[model samples]
Target: MTRIHCLVAAVLMSLSLNLQAEGADLYPLSSPAEQERFQALTEELRCPKCQNQNIADSDAPIAKDMREEVHRMLQQGASNEQVVDALVARFGEFVRYKPQLEPRTVLLWATPVIVVIVGLLVITLVVVRSRRNTETSSALTPEQRRRAEQILKDAEAP
Candidate 1:
């Protein structure tokens, strides 16, 4: 039982060490500022393969390559904007988590508001039409009212 416990402990320790080594290889920033920049940049950049996930949280190969490229650029004394611009130039605006508000993206930003306004307008028209129909239906013509009264009297006589 003691030997089994020792073996289990040794295995857990080795696994922990291997995990640490793997994590260490992922971030090779030399300074605190470089690390901070790396974290910020990774979070700001979206993974192309994983459309919803940032590069830092994605396990895709493209994300891994982007992380390596960011580290390399930072190591070579690149500014945050410089690294971001390089990536943007290579991958286009889709890779950016926060797209810039320019002419091209104006439609993208305005689409939700436009949809809401159109929906409200449709609802207003529907409600107005429904109210008008109810009002028109309730207002019977003189001939129609007389016919209705005669029908009611005949039914009562029977």
Candidate 2:
């Protein structure tokens, strides 16, 4: 009886798991035009809750809602740029995964490249300074070198 109960429980758990794994019914791609527009818009929109995922790929409730909104706007004969503009006007530039190139976002886009260049310049300066120091030390006058050696020898004796 215990073994039969365990078997039944396992079967029920598997069935429930399968049911929960069913794919969601996203808006049907009714036409190629609709699909193209959906694809283009989704790629641009960010998932507000997910830092790295776009709305189209995100399964978050907000992402689904945003996708539905985009579809509705497209169906209403809105141009892609118009739809994007509306979203930007409502949610701000952060709604887009890649923000538009503008003076406001210049720092965000340029920071990595600027940092790389500055870092390279710093590294070059450090290497050159090190080489210069080594060369200067090697060229120390004989009297100075002898005095430096004697000072080291006196310190070591203690």
TM-score of each: 0.81, 0.69
* lDDT for each candidate structure: 0.91, 0.84
**Each prediction's RMSD to truth:** 2.9, 5.1
Q: Candidate 1, clashing residue pairs?
A: none
Q: Best candidate, lDDT-wise?
A: 1
CA error at residue 92 for candidate 1, angstroms = 0.8
Clashing pairs in 2: none
Candidate 2 CA-lDDT value: 0.84
Residues 5-100 of candidate 2 have per-residue lDDT tens digits of: 999999999998876554333565668878788878987898788887888788899888888888888877788888888888876787887788
Candidate with best TM-score: 1
